[model samples]
Target: MNHPIGEQTVLITGAGRGLGAAIATAFAREGARVAINYRHSRNHAEALAASIGPQAAVYQADVSDAQAVQELVARVADELGPPTTLVHNALANFRFNGEARKHLDTLQWSDVAAQGEVAVGGLINALRALDEHFTTHQGGRVITVGTNLFHNPVVPYHDYTAAKAALMAMTRTAARELGPRGVTVNMVAGGLLRTTDASAATPEAVFDLIASQTPLGHVTTPEELADAVLFFASPWARAVTGQTLIVDGGLVCD
Candidate 1:
């Protein structure tokens, strides 16, 4: 098996379940010590850490809270050493209770703003915290998760799409600012995966449509998307920054 990215520690936000959990597990399987950050789902986080053994530990932090994030990083450093790779995947949990989907008019602007704010704002805080560490460590990686909707925009995922678009923009700007310091920032945008908690609320027809459009003739999976992230975090992508790798099974070909 290939070795882990480094002897480095990685902090993965929203690692309690779904794609986040998969990413955390992938990193652990590769031998990286992991700090699984979760807003809720403490039980799930604990279980995942257990499966990954002593190299993995769970930390609670609402990425949206600056103070909480600061403390979370501090605690992780105190335990596992300073994280050299940061994955921002935390988001407000989706409710898949078959609630009626809100229309553009019914969806409040505040709701949309909150989504972008939480994701983008949390990124800013993470970068700021990582900057100090990177200054001494010389380099690190910051990988953000985005969605293919920013390019397609036909799915009517208004809040989610808009938030991801903003994230890509922030990613580009951050890369420009951090690149000079040996830090790299990038985004891995994936199309709708078939089996993530977030996609559970999506109707079957929607999945069928996506599957039909993808050139690969099937929907992507959480682990498939995680592969693109692993690429960004690896040394192979050292020269890549401020870019978005769209892993949508060729659905949204640029």
Candidate 2:
């Protein structure tokens, strides 16, 4: 029930850049073997794996694809001894541009469906793929990346927000079912990060506006949020499951 992070092999999705890379780095720093999964950021992922040393590896898989995830899980198991922690961070990584974001009228079910395929469906595929590994190993950990937009919809990231809402629900519900199976599921929610692939397109004024409103007086960095994710993977959080720990700069309280 208490797996020290140093002994865990963490598989992080969409880990080529941005917050996912930070999360991968944090786990590697803790001496955990890391499988950095990326859909498109191949170069970044490869560089990250090299920087993390031999304990880290690069994997290419679109989490929404069931077959790809299955192959991904199998490869990780063959290479890293069955992932003890699965970090479902393969987010839409939705851009934060207000003008480019989806509005109520402009948002379509396709947009929502696309996000859902990754947000919810990806988790399902990963869990299913990891089922045997967790069972044979006796237990495992599942840490999902979430956003704080559900509490405070500061911008109109309509479809993205909707998908995360459902993901959060699944996180808790999965915990209920998986807890009995010795699997712990939880979420780490962060607000608009200071710098990430997603936030790079955000206007400087918007960043400044958000920072001013935050209690921490600064935007949260990817590393900061990534560290919070490590908490859930570490032994300290063994008894905690189906919970959401918002790692923003206290921008929104849950």
TM-score for each of the candidates: 0.94, 0.98
The sequence of per-residue lDDT tens digits that candidate 1 reaches over residues 111-205 is 77888766898898888777777876688888999988778876566776778789999999999998988888999998787787877887888
Question: Which has the greatest lDDT?
Answer: 2
lDDT of 1 at 232: 85
Model 1's TM-score against the true structure = 0.94
> RMSD for each model, in Å, please?
2.4, 0.9
| Per-residue lDDT of candidate 2, residues 164-249 (tens digit) | 99999999999999998888999999999989888899999989998999998999999999999999988889899999999888
Candidate 1, 226: how far from true, in Å? 0.8
For model 2, the superposed segments whose C-alpha errors exceed 4 Å read: none
User: In model 1, what is the error at residue 72, expressed in angstroms?
Assistant: 0.5
Pull out the clashing pairs in model 2.
Answer: none
By summed lDDT, which 10 consecutive residues of candidate 2 come out lowest?
91-100
**Would you list the C-alpha lDDT of every candidate in the order shown?**
0.84, 0.92
